[model samples]
Target chain A: LAKTTQPISMDSYEGQEVNITCSHNNIATNDYITWYQQFPSQGPRFIIQGYKTKVTNEVASLFIPADRKSSTLSLPRVSLSDTAVYYCLVFSGNTPLVFGKGTRLSVIA
Target chain B: DAMVIQNPRYQVTQFGKPVTLSCSQTLNHNVMYWYQQKSSQAPKLLFHYYDKDFNNEADTPDNFQSRRPNTSFCFLDIRSPGLGDAAMYLCATSRATGGYGYTFGSGTRLTVV
Candidate 1:
């Protein structure tokens, strides 16, 4: 397990793009960068994950640099419903994952 | 499809009383995990069971115990509920697919009164 650092909070207007970056300088070689979204009264949801380079899904995109020291979660065309606390975690292939304080994204209308 | 389901979304237990939280999953994942989250805080992993092998976190209190009777169901038992234990308990399941696409339940909100 590796410790991750992310912004405390971020705000964006609806239909805008929101980018939340996380830094894990001590990230292990086998560690993968993963992001999760947690809404009010609900469990954290898996948003996106990537080992290296860039990975895109229908929901979001995970961008990893060559160093893998940091990663960014890009949410396009944000909506009010997309507002939530986003977590960035680092974990090996088989181990219990840890959740950090995470960056809270507020998509305002 | 309700991949992961937790029973009694809201639970109220008296101080020092024992309570059990139940979780079931339809994904047929080999790994089941339990997490505790306080209000407006990040979730903390308490433990996980991978194919019936119980693995608890180093700092998790002994008061909190978990049992996995079968493949699809797991239980978290609190021997003595305290006010500090009031929070959301989330149950999540994942396969050994070498990814973090773990499916989580809605979570059980435990209120200690």
Candidate 2:
């Protein structure tokens, strides 16, 4: 399992674009970068995942550099309901997930 | 919609008593996972079952045990509940490992008296 480092918390205003970056300096070649969002009193929900390059979905976009050592989650036009804790995880095939403290995003009106 | 279902959203157990938490899934996934999350803390993986094969985490306590009778049902048994055991237990299922498209239940909040 690879360790990830992200901000403890971040604050943004409504309609602003938010980018949360995660660094996994020792990421393995087989590992994939995944992101999850968790709200109050609920289980973590799958956000986006990518092995390399950029992957866009209906909810968010994942950008992975060529080095694969770091990735960024881009949330466009944030809203008050977007407030939640975001987790970045790195895992290979057939392995359990390891979660960190995660980055808490607070969206203010 | 296919989803993961957990029974008894809130559970209250007495100290030193044994309790079991049940999880069922309609997704028919091959892997099921149990996680314990305390207040203001990250969800910690306790163990998982990959089609009847059990995989327990290295740091998980001995008192925590799990049983997967079949593909649709899995159970978490706490032999001796203590005050520290009170937390939210989340059940999740995935088609396979690598954490792909995991569907998690609403979770069962356990309280120890």
Candidate 3:
């Protein structure tokens, strides 16, 4: 399993774009970067995933560089409801995932 | 819509008492996972069942056991609940190894008294 590093917390205003970056220098060849958003008392929700380059979804976008050592999750036009703990995971075949503390994004008014 | 479902939503148990938390999925996914999430912490994987084969995490305690009667149902048994064991237990499922789009249940909040 690959370990990920992210900011402990971030503060952003509503209607602003928030980008959370994760670094996994030891990412393996078959590893895919996945992001999840978890609200208080709720299970983590899948936001976006990408192997390389950029992938966009109805909720968020994931950008991965050629190096594959790092990835970023971009949330557009944030609202107070967007405040949550964002996790970046390096997923591989059948391996149990390990989540770090994650980046807690606080969308302030 | 098809989804993962956790029963009771909340549970209160006495210290040192045994309790069971259950999960069922209508998605019919091949893999079922159990995770423990404490307040302000990340979800920790306890174990998972792929079909009938159970996989336990290296650091999981013996007190925490799981049983999967079939594909649709999985249960987590805490042999003796402790105050420290109070947390949210989440159940999830995936189609296969290296699978995406995992479906997670709302979870059961366990409170140890």
Candidate 4:
């Protein structure tokens, strides 16, 4: 399992775009980068995933550089409801995932 | 809405007493996982069931055990609860191995008194 590093916390205002970056320096060839959003007392929900390049969805966009050492999750028009912890996971095939301490994003209205 | 479900959103148990948390999923996924999350910490993998086969994490305490009688349902059993066992227990399911983000239940907050 590759260890991922993210900011401890972040602050953003409503209607603003918030981008949380994650670093996974030891990412492997078969490793896939995925992100999840977890609200207080709730399970983490899948946000977006990518092998390389950029992928966009209704909720967020994932951008991965060619090196694949890191990725970013971009949330558009943030709202107070979006305040939650965001996790970045690096998993190769058939391996159990290690959930690192994620970035806690607080959206202020 | 075929989703993951965890029962008794909150549970209170006395120290050294055994407690069980239930998880059921309508998605019928092949994999089920249990995670323990303490206050202000990341969710730690306790164990998971892959088609009736149980796998426990290396650091998971002996007190933590799991049973998967069949697909779509799994249980986390803490043999003897300690004060440190009080935390949120989360249940999730996925079709693939850790690549796809699994569906998570709201979690059961266990309080050991």
Candidate 5:
């Protein structure tokens, strides 16, 4: 499994755009970058996933470079409820999804 | 809705006692995973069952065990609950093909006292 690295914490104001980046230098050829949001006492919720370039969903957007070594999760117009730990996982069918020390995004008022 | 469900959202067990956490999924996914999450820590994979085949993580302790009966139900058995074992136990399901992310249950908060 590919190991992922992310910021320990980030602070963002409400209505601002927050971008959290993850680095997976050893990503595999078939790996996909997927991001998840986890609130207090709740399971991680899928935000967005992408293999390359970009992928957007109703909740967030994922941008991956051509090398696929890094990916970014962009949350637009954040609110206080968006404050949570965000995890970036790199995995394929053959590998289990392993979580790193996620980025705790705090959406400040 | 078709989703992963964990029973007894909260559980309190005596120290050295045994406790079981249950998870059921309606999605009919081929993979079922168990994870343990402590305070302010990332979720740690305990084990998983792909169909009837059970896979255990190399680092998982002997105190932790899991059983999957049929396709919809899976159980986590903690042989001896210690104070350190008090944490949130999360159950998730995913398809064998990957791409799609795992669907997680709300998690069962276990308190060992």
Candidate 6:
């Protein structure tokens, strides 16, 4: 399983765009990058996923470089409710999703 | 909406006692997973069942066991509970072949007394 490293925590003001980057230098060729958002006392929810380049959704955008060593999750126009812990995971077929110490984002009004 | 559901959102268990947590899914997903999440910590995989095949994480303790009777229901059985076992247990489901994201339940908060 590939390990991931992310910032321990980050703070952003409401209406600002927040980008959380994850480094997985040992990422494998078949590994896909996925981001999950978890609020207090709630389960982690899928935000976005991508294998390479940029993949945008209604909720967030995932940017993966050609090397696939790193990926960024971009949240546009953040709100107070967006405060949560975000996890970056890398997994392939039949591989269990291993979670690392996620990035805790604090959104302030 | 099709979703994963965990019964008994809150449970209080006695130390050294056996307890079971139940998870049922309406999505009919082929894979079901159990995860333990402590306060301020990342969720750890305990075990998962791909159809009828059970896969346990190497780091997971022997006291933690699971059962998947069919496609929709899976159970987490703790043979002997300890104070350290008290945490939020989350159940998630995903398709077996697509390698897509998991759909997680709200989680069952277990307290050991």
Q: What DockQ values do the models have? A: 0.66, 0.85, 0.69, 0.84, 0.67, 0.65
Segments of candidate 6 deviating more than 4 angstroms: B97-99
TM-score of each: 0.97, 0.99, 0.98, 0.98, 0.97, 0.98
Candidate 1: regions farther than 4 A off:
B97-99
In candidate 6, what are the lDDT values of residues B58-96, reduced to their tens digit? 999999999998999999999999999999999999986
Tens-place lDDT digits, model 3, residues A1-109:
7789999999999999999999999999998888988998888887888899999999999999999999999999999999999999998987756778899999999
Clashes of each: 0, 0, 0, 0, 0, 0
Fraction of true interface contacts that also occur in model 2: 0.80
Ranking by lDDT: 2, 6, 5, 4, 1, 3
Residue-by-residue lDDT tens digits, candidate 4, B48-105:
8888778888899999999998897898999999999999999989986665868899
Q: Write the per-residue lDDT of candidate 5 for residues B1-113, one digit (tens) a residue.
A: 89999999999999999999999999999999999999999999999898999999999999999999889999999999999999999999998736367899999999999
Give RMSD to native, each candidate.
1.1, 0.7, 0.9, 0.8, 1.0, 0.9
Candidate 3 residue lDDT tens string, B1-113: 99899987999999999999999999999999999999989999999998999999989999999999999999999999999999999999989856377778999999999
Candidate 4 steric clashes: 0
Q: Which ten residues in a row have the lowest lDDT in candidate 3 chain B?
A: B95-104
List lDDT for all candidates, in order.
0.92, 0.95, 0.92, 0.92, 0.92, 0.93
Candidate 2 TM-score versus the reference: 0.99
Worst 10 residues of 4 chain A by lDDT: A90-99
Question: Comparing to the true complex, what docking class would candidate 5 get?
Answer: medium
- A1-109, model 1: which lDDT tens digit per residue? 6789999999999999999999999999998888999999999899888999999999999999999999999999999999899999898988767888999999888
A6-95 per-residue lDDT for model 5 (tens digits): 999999999999999999999999888999889999999888888999999889999999999999999999999999999999988666
Native-to-model Cα distance after best TM-score fit, residue B67 in candidate 3, in Å: 0.6
DockQ of 2: 0.85
